[model samples]
Target: MPTHLIIHGRVQGVFYRDWTVSTARRLGVSGWVRNLPDGTVEAHLEGSPDAVEAMIGKMRDGPPAARVERIERSEAKAQGAEGFKRR
Candidate 1:
């Protein structure tokens, strides 16, 4: 499954991107994550259904310092992304 996610709350300075990258890679997911200008974190995750769902669950908590309020999820087209990255 390929998904687009927008995470809200204290995610910008909390190493969320780094954590997402590592976690996604570990899960055999491929995509990119970036901090949006609107104080949100946006990511494109593409992999197996289990991996994508697991990633979304992890994003809910984020890192130790992160305070995730909510996540907006939607369907996304597969990009055949090579590796997870911070964009």
Candidate 2:
């Protein structure tokens, strides 16, 4: 199943999005992550269930500089993501 996540907290300007993209690509996951105007980071990932879960876990703990507060996730339809992107 595909997974969609909306992460909130101090997750911007600290290389959060860039780190996420790198991690996702390394995991061979297809999706995109972007910075929201509300200071939150939203990402959509599609791959093996286990891989997606692992990515979510990493997102919760992000990079050393990231202070993730909460991450909301749910199942979503895959749109055939081209690659991990920033926006």
Candidate 3:
């Protein structure tokens, strides 16, 4: 299964996307992350259930500079992405 997440709060310009890519790749999760115009970060994570859940937890904390206020997640079909990316 895949998980889609919307991370809100001081996430932009705080290396959130870069951190997400590094964390997801380190966890061997395949997905894409991007910044939304609404100042939120969005991501699609796909991997083993454990890895996906781990990534979600990481998203909540984000980088040291990120002040993660909240995170929203939902299930989605896996897209077979080969690696984590920032879009």
Candidate 4:
């Protein structure tokens, strides 16, 4: 299944995107993560149900330097994402 997430908090400039790429790749999840102008991090995660859920849990905590406030998630159609990337 695929999931889209809008993560809010001290996500940008905290290595959040880099961490996400590492974590997602490690979990074998394929998608992209980017920093929104509104200071939130947006991501499209596509993988196994368990992997996606695990990624969500990790996003809630973010990187050690990040203070994740909340994460908004929704179902999305897979886009045949090949690998995790930071955008």
Looking at model 3, residue 31 earns an lDDT score of 91
For residue 70, give model 4's deviation from the true position in Å: 0.4
Residue 66, candidate 1: how far off, in angstroms?
0.2
Which stretches of candidate 3 lie above 4 Å from their native place? Answer: none
State how far residue 15 of model 2 sits from its true place (Å).
0.3
lDDT of 3 by residue, 34-67 (tens): 9999999999999999999998988889999999
lDDT for predicted candidate 2 compared with the true structure = 0.89
Candidate 1 least-lDDT 10 residues: 50-59
Q: Clashing residue pairs, candidate 3? A: none
Kindly report which residue pairs in candidate 4 clash with one another.
none
Pitting candidate 1 against candidate 3, the one with the higher lDDT is: 1
Residue 8 of model 4: what lDDT?
91
Tens digit of per-residue lDDT, candidate 2, span 1-87: 788888988889899999999999998888999988889988989888888888898999999899999998888999898778887
| Candidate 4, residue 59: how far the Cα is off, in Å | 1.0
What C-alpha lDDT values do all the predictions have? Answer: 0.94, 0.89, 0.93, 0.94
- Candidate 2 vs 4: which has more TM-score: 4
> How high is each candidate's TM-score?
0.97, 0.94, 0.97, 0.97
Candidate 1 stretches greater than 4 Å from native = none
Please state the error at residue 78 of candidate 3 in Å.
Answer: 1.4
**Ten contiguous residues minimizing lDDT sum, candidate 4:** 54-63
